[model samples]
Target: MSLRKRLIACLDMTDGRVVKGTRFADLVDAGDPVGLCLRYAADGADEIVILDIGATVDARPALLALISRAAAVLDIPLAVGGGVRSYDDAAAFLDAGADKVSINSAALADPALVSRIAQRLGSQSVVVAVDAAAHEGSWRVRSVAGTLETGRDAVAWASEAVERGAGEILLTSIDRDGTRSGYDLQLTRAVADAVRVPVIASGGAGSAADVIAVLREGGASAALLASLLHFGMVRLPELKARLAESGVEVRRPLPAPRPEEVAAWRG
Candidate 1:
């Protein structure tokens, strides 16, 4: 059986509002988290990721309420990240219905936390979110909402994350984020090559072709989209169709809307 390309929609939350931006600057509100996630789920997204953009710095609740609302409405898997600094925080998200907790700054600060969370929950439930930027001819890991540079190579960190029990790695290129150009293929491949677990590529996905490139050339198992999907620039079904035509494995498309169903909605 051919490996299927996973489609993941990312929800960047700030002040309880869904926001989208390029390169993590000038973020504009997209919509309410719950409503947006529900729409994506209905549109056939395989999984959803919620990142509390302000949680880590503000020390506020990591939008558990939003997560609960999303989990109640969407049937697919939900991964919550940002400001999850402790085991309690991770547990809170899980209890609120998140299938996985993505740790970034916290995990980098204390690598042992990954193992602890995996032990308490399970290896499959822990994801290490690595925000990396191309610097000085190398991809260095960044933390604290991409503000601080850790001086560590992206590939090495990804390897360590897996050893510490991270089942998945959500690798984002801060430089390519919001560019709508394409992914940083070298960075994606480096992390994917260093890690044994699944790698979800983020940043620089402007078109369906970008998604295809990430999976095939970057060695990413999945691709996470934000601006493209949030702004309706790329519809899920259309993108899936393109992927299918390109010989990429994707989930079957939903049946076409029946005449009566469309009319009823219109009425």
Candidate 2:
């Protein structure tokens, strides 16, 4: 039997507020990052990922204060990323509250940065995030919050990142991001197959069925959700129930009260 697939919630932040956008553009307010982090954890999200989307572009550090606040409320593992350019940057996130720190563009700019951070904090504490966009039938890595194309193959970068001491991969599809279509199964399968570490499939999650599809057909060890969960389209328990029925091993959450039950209880 395989390990139980994880359900992770992604909170994309801009200026300390949760935001969502289509194809990484057209930003819209979602909710409070800290509040959502706690809600997701209580609702049974296996892990929580908070990415400061603007940190890199603004030439600032990862939102350590925001990360610390979320981490304080999160019962599950908290992964923080964005503007992690050096060992000290990664260390600060860990010292503040993050369980794992994710490095993206900075890792691409200096591949050694991944190893440096891993050497100090342990590989398990480092997650290499790859944002890829479909280009000429192949996926190329994107950087600076999906604005710059690095011309690096997503699968190749993933394998190399793992070799350099990254314990896991947070692979996000730039094209599919915020689209709610579904995950890029081929892209996820390619990276997951090429890498020894766990791959968390992100972008394009629309429904509970989409989560099941990604975990089963995409060969992903986990799925990261944003729009659907943020918009109240699907809850964690509903997703886990769907995955269980599809014969996918999942960390089943406690039963949630039905709408009518809640209404009656409230009265």
Candidate 3:
């Protein structure tokens, strides 16, 4: 983990609209995908991630227009995921204007794809997403949007993915997703310690303290937030201020957002 922490806003999309769910169920529309992303970037998000949550299950690729439109205006990096099954798939995503392509189900099924994309596009452009769920007593890797268990240990799989050329790990805890309690510190620290690449901890960010806990005690390089930021419960600038106040090294948060901007959209 780096001394300087990163704050990322993730827009989980399905059917062109940004959506969020409790533990990936009973999804509700968050906002317009492109519009929300623009707001997050302008509000001081370090990176904006647009994930096509339904692509894999639908046997389709991520929406290109959404990525292109959002990427066109943002200066910050944009990473996208879902339905990336091959090198060509990833390359097409980059062509659509994404800074990085994240692969979850595909990576687990064919680990070689990670190396293939890394070999041609460079590891820094590849993000391997690991979604894990707590089993009887340990964490197991889940695939297809955390719906199916692959019987693989989360920590070990993360290590293999990194060795195979993944530049970073986007780790999401299925149990904690949308709970708004906090990130799974034990799961995060275990994977962070096992892998050499930076781990972007995802799920259950309800407050600034939760963010601080993951970056510090959880040993994550970055915190990936969705519901909290999407719903306006925690503004990015204020969150960064709280982080800095707690002694976590972070970029000075941008000034408070205008009233009109906040009224325009929560995401």
On the 0 to 100 scale, the lDDT of residue 3 in model 3 is: 62
Greater lDDT among 1 and 2 belongs to 1
- Model 1 TM-score (2 dp): 0.88
Q: In model 3, what is the error at residue 211, expressed in angstroms?
A: 0.7
Q: How close is every model to the real structure, measured as TM-score?
A: 0.88, 0.87, 0.87
lDDT against the true structure, each candidate:
0.87, 0.86, 0.87
* Order of the predicted models by TM-score, top scorer first: 1, 3, 2
Q: lDDT per residue, candidate 2, 5-74, as tens digits? A: 9998888888877776233222342356776777778889999988887785443443777777887777
The number of clashing residue pairs in each candidate reads 2, 0, 0
Task: Give candidate 2's whole-model lDDT.
Answer: 0.86
The top-ranked prediction according to TM-score is 1
lDDT of 2 at 193: 89
